[model samples]
Structure formats: C-alpha cells, structure tokens
Target chain A: MNSFLTAFFAGTSQGAIYALVSLGLVLVWRGAGVVNFAQMGQAMFTTYIASQLIQNEYSYWSAFVIALISGALLGALVDLGIMRPLSSRKNSLLLNSQSMRTTIPVIASLGILGVLKALAGIFWAGEERGFPAPVPTTGLRLGNTDLAITGFDLFVIGVVFLTLVLTTIFFTRTGMGLAMRASALNPEVTRLSGIRVGSVRTLSWAISGTASSLAGLLVTPKTNLSPNTLDLLLIVGFTAAVVGGLTSLAGSVLGGFILGYVIAFVNVYSAPENVFLAILIFLLLALFLRPQGILGSKEVRRV
Target chain B: MLKVSNLVTEFASIKALNDISFQAKPGRITTVIGANGAGKSTLLRTISGLERPTSGSITWFDEELTDKSVEAIVRSGVAQVPEGHAVISQLSVAENIELGGLFRKRQARGDLEIATKDVYELFPILFERRREPAGSLSGGERQMLAISRALVARPKLLLLDEPSLGLAPLISAQIISIVDELCKSTGLTVLLVEQNANTALAVADHGILLALGKVVADLPAKELIADSALRAAYLGY
Candidate 1:
C-alpha cells in the first residue's frame, strides 16, 4: 500500500509538469488560433537562459523571474511578427476556413526553429547542465520504494495548482479575461461592445507565454539540458490541448496531467512503450471518447 | 440623433449597402426590418464600425463615425449585440456580464453589476443559472445574455441584430419585453434589425425597410406595419 501511494504521489508531481505545458499550448491556441508548434523551442530557449543565469551565480529566483518575463516578451514578439498579420488577413474568413490560416505559424516556426537550433548547437552546447536544484530533494521513503518527493517536485505541483486556480479566478472575477474570451468567439461583436480585440489578443499571448516559460523552466530541471527539451514536451502538450478541447482552459489542465501520468505509467509497465504507441492510443481514444480529454467541449450541431 | 448619408459598403463585386440614408432619434427604438438579403445586417455593421463605409458618412450625435474602428465606435457610445452564435461559450455567466461595460473602467464595472442584477431581475432564468457554462444555456437564454451585455456597455446607441432569431415565440416575447423595459429605464437609443417584420415593428417607435441595400420605406414603425402592400411584398403573408 505504501509503495502504491509513493508511486501515485511521484506520478502526480510529473503529471503537474505536463499540465503546465498543456496549459501553455491551450492558451496560445485559444487566443491566437495557432498550434504554436514552436512552443517547445521557446521553452527550451528560456530554460537554457534560466540555467545559464543560475550557473553564473545569479539567484535561482531572480533567474526564474527574468526568464519568465523574457519568455512572455518573446511570445508577444512572435505574435506581433507572425500572428498579427495572419489574423488581419483571416478576420473575414468563415469558421472552417480559419484553420487554413494556421499554416502561417507552421511555416514561420520552421525558420524560427532553424535559427534556434543553430544557436543552440553553436553557443550553448556544453558537456552537461541542469537546473540549480530549485526544489532540493527528489525522494521520500514509502515502504520498500524510494518515493521521489523533492522540493522541486513540490514546487512544480504547487506552481501548476496555483496557475490553474489563478487562471480560473481571473476568468471569473476579472473583466479583461471576459473581454478576451468574448473577442475570440466573435471579434466584430465584441468590438461593437467596445472591447479592444487587438489588445485582448496580445494579452492572451503574454499570459500563455508565462505558462510556457514555467513549464520549460520546471521540466528542464528534471530531464535533459538540450535545446530540444521544450520540443519533446510539445507532443505531450499538443496532445493535452487536443484532449482538453482546444478552447477550454480547464480542459487543458485536466488533459495535461492525464497524458503525463498515463505515459509515465505506460513507460513503467509496458514492454513496447514508445512515442508511436502513445500516438496510437491517443488516436484511438479520440475516435471513441473524444470530448472527455482536456479542453474538450461537446459540440451540439444546431439544426 | 444619428444620421447616415450616402452610406456605401461593397463586398467584392456586389454592393452590400448602397447610398443608404436614415435617421434614428435619441431615446427611441428605431428598428430596421427587411427580407433576408436586404442588407439590414450590413447597414448595422457599418454604423457600428465593424464594416467601413466605402465612400459615405455616418454621423452619430453630429460626429462622423463612419471610418472609425469598432472599439472607437463603442468608445463613442455605440454598442452592438451581434447574432446569437457570437456568444462566448467558454466564459462564466458573471464574466459575460462584466465584459459589456469593459470599455469604461470605473463606473462601468460597478454599474454593470447593478445592471446584471437588473438583468437577473428581468430574466430570472439567467440569474438562476449564472454560474454554468453560457453555451449550456438555451437559445433564448443566450439572447438574453447578448442583449444584457450590450446594455452594460452604456452606449448612446445599441445595434442589435436578429434578437428573435432561432428562439421560441414565448422566449422571444420575454426578451423583447425586457429590452423594452430597459430602453424605458436607460433612455437608450437603438437600431434593432430583424427579419421578423411584424414583431420588430411592434417594439420599435420608427422603422426603416430596405430592399437590396436601398431604403424602400422610411416611416413610423406602426405605419409600416399597417401597410398591407408593403407587408405582402416583403413581410410575407
């Protein structure tokens, strides 16, 4: 029983990390209608920057703080450079046709990805690097198993929980969040209501970027120190967004944790667990029980 | 008072609105009623700054508002309750209400909450289910939310498009009555657009009827409603 509980807690912490990344993807898609395939790269870039700051004797908290703000700034820059133009051109597009506009980001990210990859390979390639142990330890004794319950794990779980709660509060209690959501559904109507859809969209990118930065900063401490760390998390984050229902914030959080924990368990037990297997399972699940995943919304086709 | 003169809005090769002219006095419900493709929605879109007039002028309280953006128009005290599908399904009920008066910061928030209380008073159903996902609401409930949000904006003019669309007759009646009561209390001007000619005319003080983007009838709402010839030609039997 102790063993099971230890494994469960350990899994929960990791699941929280997945939720963070998933939340980031969901926000980007919701506000800008882009999948942000480059999210992983952005996170990787920020994570590297944060680690560099800490390694150079900068305080971890200050490093993390600077990284977070810069990540959001980077995200806004991407929006101004890429999303703003696409949105203007696609404003009058029909509902189904809007998805076609998504190609803009996908294309733009290719060039961005190349630039990032080259920079990572040239300047940042070191022997081995990791986060400055922001959380402290990684295990607690639970019967025979060494349950990994470090301060880092706790910090991650706390951050994810806080992020989710704060997001819910903002959406509910604040007027800005409301205007953003309203603008996304129908810009013209919200505009008529006197809401500045452009400013709302920009804010969306800012918020989502913060989430992305947190995920990268947190995840990199446990995993690899490569430039592609954020990239690897992308698959999971995108999966979470798809499961959660791309438009629903709550759905993304739930989807993120589920995917994270499920994959972790599968890796533990299954003999042939691979990324391909994960994709297969998700595809099957989407076909059968589509809306149960994170951010998922049931669409009732009006007659 | 609002006066639109020589308003022209074109789409590709077609003229959605052509040299349309009308006037809506302050503190009166001036409705625009026409057939499905008579450019009523386009005219409202233009006046609200969602669409720019290609080569004309829209004067709202004696200011040229034709070329401005939607946010500017709303700042200038014109708000629109767009079609039913425009409702943001993901937001909470209270948040939905809060967004209506968001352009103006201080008094808008406090006043909007008071207005939301009034909305709940008007549509008790909305109050009862104020915490649920807005998309979960029925068509009529969505209509109530849309109009209530617009009212919170505290606009000098409200451009409401197809408020009665896809709603049950009873529900439509309830919304219209609530709108009527709010207009009375707020002394707000409105340019309501609807294809339901008879019902729209009932709530409106004056009416403008359009055909293929041209004003075919400009008279009192009751006068147009009473004209059998106009009714047979556009309003349907």
Candidate 2:
C-alpha cells in the first residue's frame, strides 16, 4: 500500500497533465467531429512561448496568461482559417470534413514544430532550452526519503483539476455550454434552433487550444525543453485519449494517468531499450480492448 | 402575408424546385401536401434560407427573403421546426425550450420561464421526463419537443415540416391540439407541411396544395378538404 500510494501520487500528477491535453482533444472531437492528431505540436509551441517569457524574467502569471491567450487564439485561427471554410462547402460529408480539418491541423502542426524549433534558436540561440519551474523546487518529505513530488507538480495537479471542474460546470449549467452541446449533436438542427453553429465550433477550437497550452506549460519545467516536447507529450496524451476512448473526457484523463503509471513502472523495471514496448502495448490495447476507454463511450458506424 | 415568386432550386443535376410559386396569409394556416419527391421539403428549406434558391424572389411582408442565411432569416422572425424530428438529441427538454427564447434579447426571464412552465402544464408527461435525454424520447414526444422548441421562440411566422410524420393517431391529435390552440391568438401565421391531409386541413384556416413544386390548389381549408378531386389528386385523402 505504501508503494502503491507513492506510485499513485507520482502518476496522478503526470495524469493531471494528460487530463489537460485530453480535455482539449475531447472538446475538438465532440464539437467538430475531428480527431486532432497534432495536439502535442500545438502544446509544444505554446510551451516554448511560456518558457521564453519566464526566462526573460516576466511574471509567472504573465507568462501563463500569455500562453493561454495564444493557445486560444491559435485554436480560433485554425477553425476560421481552415476548418470552417471546408465545412461551408454545403455537400461535404461529415467524415470528409472531419478528415480534412484534422489533416490540415496535422500538417500545420508539423510546420509549427519546425518554425518553433527555428524560433527558439533565433530568440535564444534555438538550442536545447531550459524551463523555469512554475513553482519553487521543494519536494515534500515523507518518512525522510525523497517522495519526489515537487511543488510544481502539486500546482499542475491543482490547476488541471480546477479547469476540468469549471469546464464540466460550464457545459452542464450555462447557456453557452448547452448551445455548444447542441452544436455537437447536429449542426443543421442547431442552426434551425436559431443558434450560430459556426460560432460554437470556433469556440470549441479556442477552448481546445487553451487547454492544450495549459498542459504544455505545466509540464515544461518538469521535462527537457525542445520542439519535440509537445510532439512526444502529444503521443502520450493521444494514447491516453485512445486508451480511454476518443470522446470521453474522464476516460482521457484516466487513460493519461494509467498510461503514465505503466510507463513510469516500466522505466523502473525494464531497460530503456524495452521502454517502447510499453507504448506499443498501450496502442495495441486501444486497438483491441477497451478502445473506448473507461471514461469514453463508443460511436458505431452505420453500414 | 408570404409570397414566393419563381423560386427555383437544384441539387446537383436534379431540380428540386422548378419555378415554384405560392402565397400564405397571416392569421391562417397554409398546408403544403405532396408526394415524397414533390419538393415539399425543398420549398420550405428555400423559403427558410437553409437552401439558396437558384433564381427568383421570396418576399415576406414586402421584405426580400431570398438568399439570406439561416440565422438572418430566423432573426427576421421566421422560425422552423425541421423535418424528421430534428430535435437536438443530447439536450434536455427544458434546454430545447430555452433555445426558443435565445433570440429575445429584450425579454426578461419571468415571462419566458412562465411560458416554459406553461408548456410543462400543457404536457405534464414531458415535464416529468424533462431531465432525461431527448434521444430516448418516443416519436410523438420528440415531435412535441420540436414544436415546443419552435413555439418558445415566439415567432410571428412558424414553419413546421411534417408535424405528424410518425406517430399514433392519439399522440398526433394531442400535439395538433396544442398547435390548434395557438390559432386563437391573433397575428400568428403558420405554414404546416404534412402528408396527413385531413389533419392539416382540419386545423388550418386556409390550405395550399403543391404538386411537382407548383401550387396546384389554394383555397380555404374546409373547401379544399371538401373537394374530392383535389384530395385525390394532391392531398391523397
């Protein structure tokens, strides 16, 4: 139980980070019917921006706020500049629009990764950059051994949890949230209901971007900084979503933590060469069993 | 009053509406009864701005309504209950009603909430099942919810596509009774599209018949219902 508690605490913090990314994934997928494969790239770029600001001696709140705003703006930009136009083409099937929207984001994300890599160099020599811890580096002592949970981890957990709670309330309680839900089910019906379907879709993108940025910024300090940070983090995040089920928020978060623990456990037991096996196992599980994950519900294809 | 002149529409190679023309008067119900491919849905979709007519003008109260978007048309006081029970499936019954009032920027919540309570008072079963998912609702229940959603918007002009599409006679009568009750209120215009010719004419003050996207007959509801030739040719009575 002691070992379990320690492992739980460690992975839960990491899961919170995954929860942030998963939340974004769920929002975009639910609202727009697209599987956003490049969520990590978006997050990686935002994380780079946060690190740059913090290293320049900007206030912590200012840095986080900048990242959040940029994240949301990027989300809206993607919808307005890319997805919305494709959707407006009257006869585009739902699947085609979804694929088109998702593919553009993937390509754009790859481009963004390259641009960020170059920008990171221009701004501060584009080299492997270091991250400033959002919180002070002090591990809580538990029975005199280093429990390895830092203040930053706690802050990440707390912020991510709050965001999820607030979002759940917004979706269930507010008028906008209800409209957003309606927009998800049927865009044409929502339009007939007198709601602007495009606006709701754009709002989803903005939200997805902001949440992804939050994930990137929170985890940046705990890991090495590079263009691929978000790219790698995204694979874990997507694994969490896939393992938990694509459209389930709760499943994504739970998947994130579950994946985190598996990886962390494997890192302790198996040689680094065999670590890729754990990820392969996660992907396989998503393909075979519980693909809709613990928190997710599966949608059937009409034959 | 509503007037549609030379309204033409196409879906790729097929012409959905071929120079369609008709009129619907205020304080009365106009019925458009037709076969499946007779352009009933297309006419309404064009008039309501969901589909753009290839050519011609749709004027409502002397206002040009051709080529406007769905939102613009709705904001201009035209509301529609779409075909095939287009109720937002994941939304709650109450939220469905709430959407009707979303356009009323000036109205306070007091009357609207009371109106919601009134819908519940009128349909107790719906109120009882208000918290449940709209998807799980019966066919008649979904129809009731869709019409109630439209009624909540408090539109001067209401367009209902197949209000009695799929339901038992009993449930159909219940919803039609609610729509009929609205007739007592002055200045309310409705364009009800249905295949149930008897019911459509029974509740309507005036009825218009469409065949092959053209107005085949336009007369008082009772007069058209009484016309055996028109009934057999278009109404399918």
Candidate 3:
C-alpha cells in the first residue's frame, strides 16, 4: 500500500511534465492540423541551450527564458522555411485529398527532425550531462512515511497548471488569439477578416516551441540531458494527445495524468521490462474504442 | 471607386473570369447577377485578391490593387463575406464578430465594443446568443453573423457573395433591406454577387449581367429589370 501511494505521487509529478509536452503538441495540431513530430527535436535542442547556460553558472530562470526564446525563433523559422513553402494555399488545393495534405507535412517534419538531430550531435557530441534542479528535491513526510513527491515535483505541477491557465486566458480574452483560432478553423474566411493567416501560423509555431522548451527544461532535471533524451517522451506525448482528442487543449492534460498513473502502476506491479508494451496496449485500446478522445467534440460536417 | 480592366483568372484549365472589366462607384450597391457557372463569385474573389488574375489590373480609389495580398487589400478597406455563410463554428458568436476588427488593433477594444453594439442593434438575436458557438445559429442567423462580422471592420468596400443563398424569402428580404440601409446610412460601397437576379436587381443601384465568364450587360438596375428580351436571353427571369 505504501509502495502504491509512492507510485501515485511520483506518477502525478512526472505526468505534469508530460502534460506540458502534450499540450504543445495539441496546440500545434489545432493551429496547423499537423502532428509535428519535430517537437521533440525542438525541445531537446532548447534544453541543451539551457543546460549549457546553467553549467556556466547563470541563474536557472534566466537560462530557461533564453532557451524558450531560442525555441520560439527556431519554431518560427521551421514554419517559414519548411512548412510554408511546401504547403502553400495553392499547393494544398492542388493536393486536394486530405491524406496528401497531412502526409506532406509529416514527411517534412521528419526531415526537420533528422536535421535537428544531426545538429545536436555535432554540438553536444553524444554526451549525457546532468541538469541542476532549480528547486530542492526534498520530499514531504506524510504520517509515518516520506511521500515520493518533492519540492521540485510540486514546482513542476505549479508551473504546468499556471501555463495552462495563462494559455486559456490568451485564447479566450485576446483578439490575436481569437484570430489564430479563426485562422485554424477557416483560413479563407480568416483572410477575408483581414488576418494574415501565414503570420498567425508562424506565431502558433513560436508558441509551440516555447512550450516544448518548457517541458524540456522541467524534465531534463529529472534525467540526464542528451540530444535524443526526449525521444521516448515525444512518443508518450503523442499518445497523450491522441488520448485527449488531438484537437482539445484541456483533454491533453487529462490524458497526461491518466497516462502517468497508468505507467507508474504498471511499473510497480508488473515487470519493468514490459512497461513499453503496457503503454502501447493502452494506446491501441484508446484509439480503437474512443477515437474522438475524452473531451473532443464530434467532427463537424465540412461545407 | 473600384475599376477592373481586362481582368482574367484561371483555375487549372478553366477560365473562371475572362477579360472582365467594370467599375463599382462609391456609396452604391452594384449587383453582379448570373447563372451558376457565370463566374460572379470569381469576379469578387479576384478584386479582393483571393484569386490571382492572369492578366489585367484592379484599381481601388485610383491605387493599383492587383498585386496586393488578401490581407493588404482588406487592410486597405476591402472586406468579403464568402459564400456558404462561413463562420468559425468552434468559437462563440461574439468571438467571431471580434475577429472582424483584428487588423485595427489600435482601436480594437473601443471599436469592437461600439461595432458589437451596432451589430446587436442590427441583429438583436446575435446579442442574445453572443456566447453561443456560431455553428448553433440557424441559417438566417449565420448569414446575419457573417454580415455583422464584416461590418465590425467598418470596411469601405463590402464584397458580399450570395448573401441571399439558401434562405427563405422573408429572411432574404430582411438581409437585403439591412444591406440597403447600410449603404444609405454609412455610405458603404457594396459589390453583391447573386444568382437570385430578381431580388438582386430590385435592391441594386446598378447591375452587371455575367454570362460564361464575361459581362453581357452593364446597365442601370431599372433598365436590366425592365428589359424582358435581355432578361429572357440570359437571366432566366
């Protein structure tokens, strides 16, 4: 029972990190209708910047900010340089078919991922370095036992929740955010409404970059930093997004928590070697049974 | 004033607009009425920069607008309400309306409030259901939301494509009257493209009849309505 409690708390804390990464995936999906597999590459690249800055004895928060900004710039560049040129309005119409529209971006993103991975290898050189935790890792004592949750864990939870709140406010309260939503829904109408859909799409990618950077910063401290350190997390993040309904923001967070606990419990009760299999089984079940996800609306009829 | 000379647009191998030329005078409703394949919507789209022309020029207020992007054209006071009553179905009615003035951020808050108030006055039901998703509105209400959204931008040239499509007669009349009122009250120029020739000519100050991607007639609204020979030959009235 004590072991169960420990796993539960640990799962929730780790789930917070996954939520941040999954939320970024969901945002980019809603904005551009593509599952950006290059997100992990972006996160890993930015985290290296933060790790390098921290190693130079800079303040942790300052390093974090710099990393986030760098990530945003990189994301914007990716959209402008790669996605825009490949998927212009004319080309999309020519492509016509829905499968072609999605497939082209997925392929482009894979190429981007390969390039980023190569760049990371050249700079970081396959080294795994430990990251300094911004907050203390001391655990809380509950009754007769020390809970596995630490101050750092609590900080991750707090930051993730705060990010979600701020994201919600930006979408609901700001005009630019509303324009972004409109652009995603119907680009032609949004263009007629005077919004530069291209610029809005670039901005959405920037925000996604910042978010992925944040997830990298939070998660790197719990594990050693490496170029491909986030590869597994990216797969998990995609799973979370699918579980939450790919289009929903809040649903991704819920998916993260659900995934976190399930993985933790599996790790505890079952052979640790079977953890990956357990997650894959859960994902397949979710996709087959509940494709729209927990909070996703039914697909509306396209006029 | 808006002028088009020798404008041509093609979609793949098809000529959607072929060497079209006309002028839309300020503060008046100029209706383009045609059959389904006559390229009425294509004309509006080319002027607004959604569809690129293969040849010729479009001048708005003596300024060349042929090469401008859709956003730039809109910022320069051209706005379009596309066919099928397009709305951001995921967003609330109020948010959809708010998007209309997205480019004019310097006056967005103040202008949005005033414009929203005006829209509510123009269509009170939209105000009552401002918080509801735009998809939930009835077809007539969605048409009203599309028009109201375009109004929020306070555009000088409003390109309305088939506002009367897919609506009952009474509701269509209400929309036309509101548009007529807007032209009179605000001095707003409108380029209305419609398949409903009879209703379109009744409200228009001037009419252009398009046939097979070319203009067949450019006459005063009264003349187009009264010319039974021309009407029978083309308009099917």
> Which structure is stronger by DockQ: 2 or 3?
3
- CA lDDT of B29 in candidate 2? 80
By lDDT, is 1 or 3 better? 3
Relative to the unseen true structure, what is the C-alpha lDDT of residue A292 in candidate 3, on a scale of 0 to 100?
A: 87
Specify the highest-lDDT model's number: 3
Clashing pairs in 3: none
Better of 2 and 3 by TM-score: 3
Better of 1 and 2 by DockQ: 1
TM-score of each: 0.87, 0.91, 0.95
Q: Rank the candidates by DockQ, best first.
A: 3, 1, 2
Candidate 2 lDDT score at position A195: 80
Question: lDDT by residue for model 1 over B1-237, one digit each (tens)?
Answer: 999998899987589998998899888899898888899888988888777778889998878898788888888888888876456675656666667777776755576667667767877887788877778888888888887777766677888899999988887777777677767887888888988877778988999989899999999998998898987887675
lDDT tens per residue, model 1, A232-251: 67777777777777777777
Candidate 2 falls in which docking quality class? medium
Q: Which 10 successive residues of model 3 chain A have the least lDDT summed?
A: A294-303
- Scanning candidate 2 chain A in windows of ten residues, the lowest lDDT window is A294-303
Cα lDDT of model 2 by residue, B66-151, tens digit: 97788778877788889987786666777777776665635556767766876777678889898777777899989888877876
Higher-DockQ candidate of 1 and 3: 3
